[model samples]
Every structure is written in structure tokens, then in C-alpha cells.
Target: MLELKEITKIIGDKIILRNFSLALAPGESVAVIGPNGAGKSTFFKLAAGLMQPTSGEILLNGEQIKKKTHLLKKRIGYLGHESFLYSALTPLENLRFYGKLYKVKNIEEKGMELLKAVGLHYFKDIPIRSFSRGMIQRLAIARVLLTEPDFLLLDEPHTGLDQEAVSLLNLLIKERQEKGIAILLISHDFEQVIQVCERVLILNKGRVVEDKSIDHQRGLMPFKNWYEAAVSGK
Candidate 1:
């Protein structure tokens, strides 16, 4: 459902991404892991059409993303490292605003459902400025779900989340995957990554050095071993 072909991104004199490529099929969940400065966020920005690659192209479905942004925006949901919430707006107001932007049907009902799902129903009328980091994160998740996107790009979505919020995040990921949403997420939480994604891609120095499928039967040990080996150049 999403494809990046031979993408290279350079900023100033430094290269951030070099000939990077990846594809996500419908209903598939992929996790990207790497050390700091591995260009994971840059890759997400390229895919989301928030920034252009110096070379290569990003496609959603069959159309090039840069050339079809307006049409593609409705089909994709992106959650970045920051919550990007309007602090002055109430949770209900925030969802209603985005829901209207996406032209979502029954926005009021849908907004309430999402607020409840993210455990923010009680705070629906409260402005986000008073919320704690985790609460804002939960409300952000609710905001992203307002459009029911077909493709999800999440960058460190687990940031500021507690164990309960993380559990809710996992459940939402599973539900979206079951509904045939294509997902690409960057995360350092190995345990949660194992629970949510079917495949893992290890990016190093702007390149995908290893792509491995999770072996659920063997558990996290195998993934840890593989990641260590890959990063250590084993």
C-alpha cells in the first residue's frame, strides 16, 4: 500500500538517507529500529510527503505522493514524536476540528468513541494545556484515529505513554492491522515492537541493513540477538 523507491535525502553537506527503499503491503505492520541519527524520522517525513527526497519517489497505492498529496492525505495518518495538539482546545474540540477536516461521518459520535477508547472521555471538555504528557499523548492517538486512515506512519508513538497507555496503543495497532491498514512505525521499545509488528527492519547509516520477520514462537531473544548481530556487523 506504500512504497519508497531508491530514496536519497541530503541536507546541507550531510547525507541523511542514501538509496533507501521499502514497501508495505496492506494489512502488514513493519517496525524500524536503529541508533540515533539513523535517518528514521527523515524517512518518515519523505513517505508522508512532509519533505521531498533528493532523489527517488514515494507512492501510496499507485500514485506518487508528492504529486497527489491532497488526495492521499485522507488515506494516511501520521503521528510524529511531538503530540502536535492545540493546547487551548479541548479534546472534544480538537477531534471535532480534525474530523471536519477529514470530512468524517458522524463526527460527534465518532469523536466520543475515540475519546473513550483512548481513556480521555472524562477530559473531553478540558483544555489540553492542563494535561500531563501521557494524557496529551493519549489524546493525540485519539486525534489520529479521527480519520480512520488506511496507512499509518508512527514515529516513536510510545513516547510519554505509561504501561496502560502502551497497552491501549498495542490494542489499537492490532485492531488497525486486522482491518487491513498498512503500518510503518519507528520504535525503540523492543517488547512492544514484537507485539505489534510482523516484520522488523534495521536501518543503519541511512540504509536498511537487515529485514527480519518476527518468530513469535522463539520470542524476543531471537529479535534481540538478530539486532545485536546486525548492528555489530556480525
Candidate 2:
């Protein structure tokens, strides 16, 4: 459903991504693991069309995304590190605003349903500025889901989430996968990555250095060991 071909991003004298390429099939989920400054977030931005690559191409559903950014916007959902919510807006109001932006059908109904899914229905009328970090993150998830996007790009989605909230996230991702939404995520939590992703890509110094499938039978420790080894250059 999404493909990045030889994508390169350079800023002044620094290269953020070097010929990075990846393909995510419909309903498939992939996780990106890397240390700080490894370009994971940059990859997410390029995939979401928030930034353009210095070279190469990004495609969605067989169309070049750079050439059809508007259409691409309609098909992808992105969750950055920040909640990006309006401090003065309540959960309901925030969803209502974004729902309209996405031209979602039954906006009110959808907005309410999403708030409920994220456990924010009770706080629907309360201003977001008073919310806890996890609460705001939950609301952000609701905001992203309002569009029912075909491709989901998440950067550090587990940040600020408690155990229950993380479980909720896992459940949501499983549901999206069942419905054929492609997911691309950047996460430091190996457990979450193992739970939701079939494949893992390790990025270092602006390039993908390791790409491998998760062997569920091997359990968590082995995967953790592998990731540690990869990142530590073992």
C-alpha cells in the first residue's frame, strides 16, 4: 500500500536519510527501530507527505505521492511525538474539527465513537490543556482515527502511554490490520514492536541497516537481544 524507493533527504551538509527504501503491503505492519538521529522520524514525515525527500520517490497505492499530495493526505494518518491538539478545544471539539477537515461522513457520530474508543468520551467536553500526557496521547489517537485512513504512520506512538493505554493501542492496531490498513511505526519499545509488527527495520546513520521478520516462536528476549546487537554494532 505504501512504497519508498531510494529516498534520500539532505539538509545543508547533513544527510538525514540515505537511499532509504521500503515497501509495506496492504494490511501489513512494520516497525522501525533506531537510536537518536537515526532518521526514523524523518522517514515517517516523508511517508506522510509532511516533508519531501531530496531524491527518489514515495508512492501510495501505485501513485506517486509527491505529485498527488492532496490525494495522499486523504489516505494516510500520522501521529507525531506531540499530540498536536488545540489546548483550548475539548476532545469532542477537536475531533469535530478534524473530522470536518477529513470530510468524514457522520462527523458527529464518528467523532463520538472515536473518543469512546480512546477512553476520552467522559472528557469530551473538558478542555485538553488540563489533560495528562497519556490522556492527550489518547485523544491524539482518536483524532487520527477520525479519518479511517488507509495508511497509518506513527512516530514513537508508545510515548507517555501507560500499560492499559498501551494495550488499547495494541488492540486498535490489531483491528486496523484486520481491516487491511498498512501501518508503519517508529518505536523504542521492543515489546510493542513484537506484538504488532511482522517485520522490523533497523535504521542507523540515515540508512536501514537491518531488515528482518519477527519469529514469534522465539519469544521476546531473543528479539530484544537481536535489536540490542544490531544497534550496538555487534
Instruction: State TM-scores per candidate.
Output: 0.96, 0.96
lDDT of 1 by residue, 1-234 (tens): 788899999999889999998988999999999988999999988777788789998887777877677666788888998887899999999999999998999999999999988889998889999999889988888888889998898999997788998999989889988999988889998888888888999999898999978887778888888898898888
Please report the candidate that would top lDDT against the real structure.
2
Which ranges of candidate 2 are over 4 A from the true structure?
A: none
- The RMSD of every model to the true structure, in order and in angstroms, is 1.3, 1.2
The TM-score leader among the candidates is: 2
Compose the digit string of candidate 2's lDDT tens values, residues 124-150. 899999999989988898888889999
State the lDDT at 176 in candidate 2: 90
